[model samples]
Target: MDELKGEWFETWFDTSYYHILYQNRDFTEAERFINNLLGYLDLPKNVNCLDLACGKGRHSVFINKKGFQVTGVDLSSNSIKEAKPFENETLSFDTHDMREVYKENTFDVVFNLFTSFGYFDDYDDNLKVLNSVNKMLVSEGLVVIDFMNADYTLDHLVEKEVKTLDGIDFNITKSYDGKHIFKNIDFTDQGKEFHFQEKVQAIKKEEFETLLEKTGFEIQNIYGDFSLAPFNKKESDRLIIIAKKK
Candidate 1:
């Protein structure tokens, strides 16, 4: 239960406030993306799937509803506990680290969605995640990584904002230092002020391609957005990469 391990994500993501801050994420849009991906992949019914970094099993639930067996894994024990209610014969959730391979050559598809990456300070740590993904896949299995388009994000950076949600005033500031984007979030809850920092490495498309190549995956396709549009470096909101095991 040592949530504060020096990593910003290790502390921030375990709090209830994190969920409150992101509660407005578009579920319909995510569902559309998942459906589009499922159609595009045309994976076999019986093949197992892994929802890597699946927070609270939303995507896992959707995929399982599509009749695919899924195992959702996340680093947050609280997330796993909340997700366990959705488990059944074909759906399960476990607390796990993405840098370690949970089951070798077991899943037909692995999904790392919603910018649930780039948290590690060291680039090699990110590479370790890719290696783990590669090891967890069957031969020719597919992996989809959904990440923010760094180029576009840098171009459209919002420096500061103040918002009130549920009577809590959140003051947020953002900055990017070439290699990483940092967000400083300040808020007051129950008369006590609190501050949290979130840092994500600003990994680019070329860097990801290099990592995937090094990890023994063949690049299958790259989409620009949740709608499966072709990737345009400066225009896309998301960088969705689909790769197959070599």
Candidate 2:
């Protein structure tokens, strides 16, 4: 896998509507997803957490407000720079490529929310991030990977849609290439338009489980949504997994 090919993530997520989508009025729903995943882990309030690919500090801030110490990392310098103003004693953000392992056994919980895992252009490059994450977890530490239900996403695929957030209109289109899901976004505000493309690997559940197992993590729980309902192939909006280091 070519490492440099995945650099598009930095541009697509940094200065685009990506921030608006998660930080706008939908914040309540985002908070609910974070809290629900946290509840399933049942870790101590003071546990240290690593928010991988943390965008605009959404989930990171929520975790901090819940009394956990959080360190967020993202490839986007712009997002981290914006996140700096929102940090406190318990919350901090840094700009780093997730493929590189920095701290070992440093976090009791490593949270990768909102399908942030599959952004890499290649499957193996994506697995590098998971390998690094596996090394970051403490013994018996918890890992909560929140992603869209791929089967459902494919079954009820929405090829194109228009949505409004923070008074801006967004035209979104999706393309699934068997292994990758590409989203083309056009944002319009006050007659100004901006466009960007984001590609996330459309990795299936079995494939993800294989990645986890190859990286030496044991899959413990799999849920279809934030509510923690059991995963069903035909029904579910989200695919949330709780795994432990083996």
Candidate 3:
């Protein structure tokens, strides 16, 4: 699809251009973040992990390498296809929606990393995701949510930018309209123009605290960045939350 036709997330994320635009990803940072999280959790050997919205199984592969049985699930079938070759006896990939329980009370941990939350238009759908995670996790199992700090992101928002990757130039614009952050991407590839819009709810820390507590999860820690640093509203880059099912 050269133009935005279906849902923003599904259509855009499944496109080849999306992968090409983000090919030179910061893999080092992602690895470091996963390393810090796994070390801090200090989970038991061979514990089960469900990597929700695990695009291309990056985190799932890393976790499986750490001796855990990891199952990665994403909404994009293309991403799952890309990740299937990495699977082994203890690692697998599938296409799944985060708003539904993939398996009830089966995983010792659930990971919703890389700002995967807050895409739906309905606020209650976010609650549905949390609820689904609650059902998917066993009692006392942990859930890690790595989301962007909405306030900090809005404060330092880039209105416009052009990123050239793999000989393709992507023109992007971002803005926050009171309740949601909107990102409009425009680019031309192979002489055809494409446009995609990404919208995510600008839910804040207080909001997540309420949602998690309401969904039977007790917040154990709130870090502002992947370094496990204390949260600072004005300066931190990410809002990483670790919670346990009550």
How accurate locally is residue 178 in candidate 3, as Cα lDDT from 0 to 100? Answer: 91
Better by TM-score, candidate 3 or 1: 3
lDDT of 3 at 2: 62
Tens-digit lDDT track for model 2 on 165-192? 8888778899888888888777766666
lDDT of 2: 0.83
Clashing pairs in 3: none
lDDT of 1 at 70: 99
Off by over 4 Å in 2: 1-6, 20-25, 164-169, 187-194
Which residue pairs show collisions in model 2? none
Candidates ranked, most accurate by TM-score first: 3, 1, 2
Q: Estimate each model's TM-score.
A: 0.97, 0.89, 0.98
Tens digits of lDDT, candidate 1, 1-246: 123465787688889888888888899999999999999998889989999999899999999999999999999888999999999999999999999999999999999999999999898999899999999999999999999999999999999998777778879999999899999889889877888889998899999999999999999999999989999999999999999999
Model 1 residue runs over 4 Å out of place are: 1-5
Measured by TM-score, the strongest candidate is 3
